[model samples]
Each structure stands twice: as structure tokens, then as C-alpha cells.
Target: MSKQFAFTAEQLKSFRENGYAGPFDAYDQNEMKETYKKLRAEIFDRSHAIYDLEHSSLLAGYDRHLDIDFFSRHIMRRQILDKVEGILGPNLLCWRSEMFPKYPGDEGTDWHQADTFGHASGAPQVVWPMNTDFGGAITVWTAVTDADKENGCLRFIPGTHEEMHYDETKEMKYSPEQVNKLEKNGMKSGFFGYDYRNLQKDPSWVPDDANAVSMEMKAGQFVIFWSTLMHASWPNTSSNRTRLGFTARYVPTSVRIYPDTDVINEYGSKLSLDKYGVVLVSGQDEYKHNRRLLKNARGLEFATALDELETA
Candidate 1:
């Protein structure tokens, strides 16, 4: 496998310290634009989508990589997998992917961290081994369109991944009516339909935005970060431009995904995991804790470095 996009020693060191790394180049501007155009066309065609939900539902964007060939290939890209392997080891599995679109006048995402990813749903979505107390997926977020402060760029607080500020077990009321209406520290933000502040360990404490750094990226650039990092985004304050981001969440093969849950209930929608399966993007899965898929819903096989080597 080519090590062209693998994280350097310095980059890995910085990632270990800061809990995040890179707005690395994945696709050129023209390629990204063309991909975006094709994605727009395919997004509405939910024939192969795993979830049966209305297009307007917030949960509609979940796990498209399972059905979309482009996304299936995207999650297996060397640029992304190599960096993820550097952190999570060679045995990697992509369990989830979500589409984040910030239309004009849309409120920014609330500042929050997800360890078990159960803030919205009452049950834990992912659980690490009993030996490890720390658990959170590595998220690779790619900018599908140009993102800036005006168009809702991502913001992160470095070195915040180790500690848990919010309790995932805490129940957060989903209130879609409150979207774009709530303001925090003079900034308009909300966690999709739910208020993330409800899950805070300390109800009186607030995030220190003074230390937060904005990640403004060009089209096709991707950033890797821990899912436990305290992160959010700016409101899309632009008159017309909309910010689009795609995030793929990865964890080592040993982690148990969706333990004891066949149905996912979040964002006021319910989804059955009957067709859900994690993609083994790199290496081998000896633990086999979760269902693994070799091909996407479109019948296109997911290519990995090992697969390429065997074929070559």
C-alpha cells in the first residue's frame, strides 16, 4: 500500500497532543465539485438506503456509505484509512457516517462530545471492551464544499478528548421547534433537534470558546479528530452559500457496535439495523464483535489495501 497520505511522525505527535489533525487534501477542487454534483443527484434516491425515513428527517443522512458506492469507496480511501490506522491500529472498522449540511440561516451545531454516542438515544450506541474505560470513535470529517467562518466551519478545543464533560446516559429532550431559536454565549447553536447542554456533567459549566480553533477548509479537504473532542461549528451566516460536510466514524474491530439494539431511535425518527453492517476498511477483524460487510448495497465491493495486494 502507498504511504503517500499517511500521517508523519510529527503529525501523529501533534494528533496525540491535540486530539485532532489535518485539513489534508483528499480531492482537488474540480473533482470535489463534480463529486458533490453527483452526490446531490444520488442523495434523494433512497432505493438502496438502509433506513426507511423521510428525506426531511434529521436521521435520514445516517449511514449512507452502506448503500452508496462512492461513499463505500470513500471510507476505504488510503488517505483516510492510513491516518485512522495510525491512531486506532491496523484493524479498523467504519461503523457510521453522517451528512452535515448547514444551509443559509441554519444554526451551528452545539458544542458537545460523544463517547458512547447515546446522548440522543437513551441506549449506548458503541461500547469498548471491558478492559478499556475510554471509548470514542475516530471521526474523519470531509468538507464536501468550501467551509469558512461565515459558512459554518468546524471549531475544536485541543486536548479535550481524554476527559468526559457530558454523561451519555443523561436524557436530552428532542425539541425540533427550538432549532435556530436557542442562543448560547451570543452564538446561535443547537444539536440538530436536541439540546446537547442537557447532557452536561456540570449543569452550570460552559465551554471555553477562547481556546477553540476554527477549521476552515477548502472543498475535498478532510480532518481527523477524536469523537470525544469538544467540537462545534459557526452558524451559516452567509446570504447564500451552504456548507456541506461528510463524517465517517471509525473504531478498532474489538469495539462492540449497537450492543443489544436492533433499532436506532434518534432525532425523532426510528431506524431498523436489519441491513446495517460495519465496513472493515483495513486489516483483519479477529474479534468479530459487529457484523462486517464486504460489499455495499449497490453490489460494489469495498476495496482495501489487502484486497488490492492480493489482486495485483
Candidate 2:
């Protein structure tokens, strides 16, 4: 019998053709509202957070699954893993999670594609086995608040994941002042502080937005897509709404996480990996290339992989 939450054959076919999939339900609206309130409080108190940075730091949102109880559980939810298991097989590891928040009038995220995720850091954060032509993590982005174009919802260009439009090895200069100052074809957007267009393989190229699709998800819902997909978001034009998104990145256990790296220097900040470890959300890890943490700093044990739990 098929596993619960597993994608149907038709859905798998659509995912293959479109290079992305659903805004599936992960939480109820009322539940999300209450959970978000608690999350906000926990987010600000980072005494036990993996990184030894201030709460106000730009990279403060890097990985709270290591310390926060809610995030630890959220990352391992069966609802997310069941669907992710469909694309990545059963063996998987959650290598990273990040918070993306856009306030009213904030600039949109620039069109970008991340395969190795080295465009800014100058080192491939994740590496697949040799001879593989393509390598990219599957990103599950969940909306912590209602997301709409008026509040900077995500945009995706279908069927673009198979191609590499940008060279991630290229370096992009980080400039915080340029956040809301840049405009792409009259669209207000910028990649955090860096201009993502700097890493484009073709300087004269521009993503054809005519074929792009806006993904507006309600709070507590999630959309899954390839990190290599041509994706971006629109500027928040709302008067007071804030769009919050939490992204959890997953990859097969065979892949190497932060190959031979102890520190990550990106987004104008250098973060040490002394407390960083990958969480195995599903199946087993045979390669053992990365450190695996079985629990959060709060002594809360992570939920075992669905298959593992079912068998045990």
C-alpha cells in the first residue's frame, strides 16, 4: 500500500514537468496563528540558538531547529517528509532551515537559482557524487503568515530547474544599502543584500516573467520546489502586512553537507559550524558524511523517520 501523504502518480508527473509541487496543508489557520505567536517569542530568545550571534544579526534566522522545540518538530513533520520522500526516495537529511521575512514596503527576493549555493560564500555548501550532472536541494518553504503578491509571495518559472541560468561559483558583492534601491525591469526586488543578477551566466539575460507563476499561500501551508528552479518574489506593496516564510532544505544522505567546511561566510557574515549538525528526518544514513543530531538543545528528541518508526 502507498504511504500516507505520498504524492499520486499524476502529481509526481506534474512535479517532474513543472519542476515544483503543491501548497499542501501542514497546519490549520487557527493553529498557525497561535503557534506563530509562540514562535515569535522563542525566535527572539536565542540564548541556546546554535549560532553565537545576536538576535538582531542578519543570519540569526539561519537554523533554529537545533535549539527551538517547535522548529525541531516542524522540520520532521510526517506531512512534509511523506511528500519529500516521494521525490528524494526514503533516505534524506535536512541540512538547513532559514527564515525569510518581508515587512511592508520591503523589496522582493530577486530571481535566483541555487544549485551548489556557493554564489556568495565561494564554497559549495552541498556536494553530490561525481558524474552526476545536476545537484540541488529540495526546499520546502512554509508560509508562517498569509502570503500574497501584495505582501511579497513567491514567484516561480515552471520547467526551469533542469537548466543552469546562473553560475553559483561566481561571486556577488554584498551591499546592504542596495536592498530596496534596485529595480529589475520596473519590479522591486533584491537578493537579501546582494544583487543576484551578478551571478547570472549571461549578463544580458533576464528571466521571462511572462511564463512565471505567483505562489500565494495561506499561513500554515507549504510549497515544495527545487532550489535550482528559476524563482523569485514580488515586492510587498501592502500597508502593514508582513509575509514570513520558513524554508527547510533537504537532500539525499549520499550528498555531502558543507564539504570539509567548519565555517560559512555569506550574506556579509561569517558563521561557525561548531554547533551545526544535520537532522535525519527520514530513512537511514549510510554515508554518514555529516554530523547528525538526534535532539534539540532543549533535550527534545527529534521524531524518528516515518519508515524507521513504523518498523520499530
Candidate 3:
């Protein structure tokens, strides 16, 4: 890993205190725009996608890195891996990647935090070892388009990653018809198809947004944060602009992903795990608790952090 891309001591301290870090540059604006054009077309082609679903479904955005060449390389970029290594140590596994697009008049995402990532499926998706103190994955969110308040940029309440505000074991009813029709605190918001408030530890409690910080970023910039942080987004009020984000989730090799599960049931869709596997982004996986994919679905071998360093 290049020392130039690694987080400095001051930045690491801030990450620990704020539960998030950076809007660091990854690609130039023109490069991102060109990549976005290709991504839009590649995303629509689901012939090789692991999950069988329509483009209209929210679950259609899940795990494209396993099939798309761009995403496969995007998840392994040395610029990203170096920063992620600073937080999660040397060995890392990218278990999940999702595409988030907010069009005009789209409702903002609900204020929620994911620990086990089972608020909708009613089953734990990722489980840390019993001896570990943390439970959530380190999520690296990259802006595929310019993201701002008008285009549904992300919002975060600092220092909230340590506590669980919402219980994942709690069931949240998924209603596809209710999407983009719900409102919270006068702002249009909803959690895909389900109301995230349903999983709140305290039903009457509401998220205090006074201290929330907006993470506005230009295209190609990325931020890293714990999945347990209290976070949400502003509604895309623009008439023509769209906000798009790509999130790659990482955890230490010791973590077990999708323990005791074969199929994923969420967002009114069912996906088979027969072809699903996590990518080893950095170092060696000594614990091998989850299935590992040496290459993408298209047969292109993934370039690991170790591979990049050796070649450099």
C-alpha cells in the first residue's frame, strides 16, 4: 500500500472521535462522469448478476461488484484499500456492495443504523466473533455523481457508532407500495420499502438532527464510516439532477458473513446464495469463515491489495 493514500494520525484520531472520515478524492470529475455512463448501461444488464431480480426492485442494486468489471476494480482500488486498512487492519473482506440512486422528487433515506444488517430479513447477515467489541462493517461510500443537499447527500450524527439505536432482530414490515410516500419530521423519508423507525429500540424516540452533518461531495469523492453510525440523507428536491452513490462494505477476515444462510430474503425479493462469495481485498484470510471468490462472475481475477503492492 502506498503511504500517500494512507490516513494520517490526525485523520485517524478524527475518525475514531467522529465515527466517520473523509471526502477524499478517488477519480477526476471527467473520469467519474465517463465511468458513470458505462456503469448505467452495465447495471441494467443483469444476465450475469448473482441475484435474479428486475431493475425496478431495490434489491437489484445489491452485490454488482461480483459481476461488473468496473465495480470489481472499484472495490479493490489501492486508494480505497489503503484507507480501509488504516481502520480495519491488514486483512479485509468486501462482503457487500450496493448502488444507491436518488432521482428527482425521491424520498430521503430514513435515519437508521445497521449492526447485524437484518432489520428487514429477520436474520443476521454478518456476525462478528463473540470476543470482538464491534459488530458492524466499515462502509466506504463513493459518490458516482455530485451529491449535495438538493440531490440527497448523506447525513451523519457523529460519535453514535458505539451504541445500538435500532435492533436488527426486530422485524420491520416491508411494503413496496409505501415507498416515496412516507414523511418524517416534515422531510420525505423512508427505508427503501420499510419504515426503519419500526426497529427503533424506543418507539417514541426520534432522531435529533440538530447535530447532524451533511456529507456533500463532488463526483468521485468517498467517505468511510462505521455501518452502526446514525445516518440518513436529504431528499432529492431537484427537477433534473440525480444523486448516485456506490457503497462497498468491508470487515476484518475474522467476521462471518451470512452465517447459516443459503438464500437472502429482503425487499420483496429472494436471492440464492449458491453463487455468492466475498472478495479478499487485502492480506490473507486466516479464518476462512465465509466463502471466498478468487475472481468475478465474468472470470476476471480480482486484484488484491497484496497483488498491487507486490507489482508496485
The lDDT leader among the candidates is 3
lDDT of all the models against the reference? Answer: 0.91, 0.89, 0.92
Model 1 spans > 4 angstroms off: 305-312
Point out the worst 10-residue segment of candidate 3 by lDDT: 303-312
The TM-score between candidate 1 and the true structure equals 0.96
- Over 1-312, each residue of candidate 2 has an lDDT whose tens digit, in order, gives 468888999999999899899899999988998999999999889889888763253588888888989889999887898999999999899999999999999999999999998888999998999998768999999999999989999999999999999999987898977878899788788988898888889999978889999999999999999999999999999999999999999999999989988998887778899988999988789999999887788888777734465688
Query: What digit string (tens of lDDT, one per residue) describes model 3 on residues 198-307?
Result: 99999998888889999999999999999999999999999999999999999999999999999998998778999999999988899989999988999878887447
lDDT of 1 by residue, 1-312 (tens): 667778899999999999999899888988999999999979889999988884366787899998888898899888888888899999989999999999999999989999999888899999999989569999999999999999999999999999989999998998888989989878899998889999999999989888999999999999999999999999999999999999999999999999999999888878889999998888888998898877788888888634856877
**Candidate 3 similarity to native, TM-score:** 0.96
Order the candidate numbers by lDDT, best to worst.
3, 1, 2
Reference-based TM-score of each model: 0.96, 0.96, 0.96
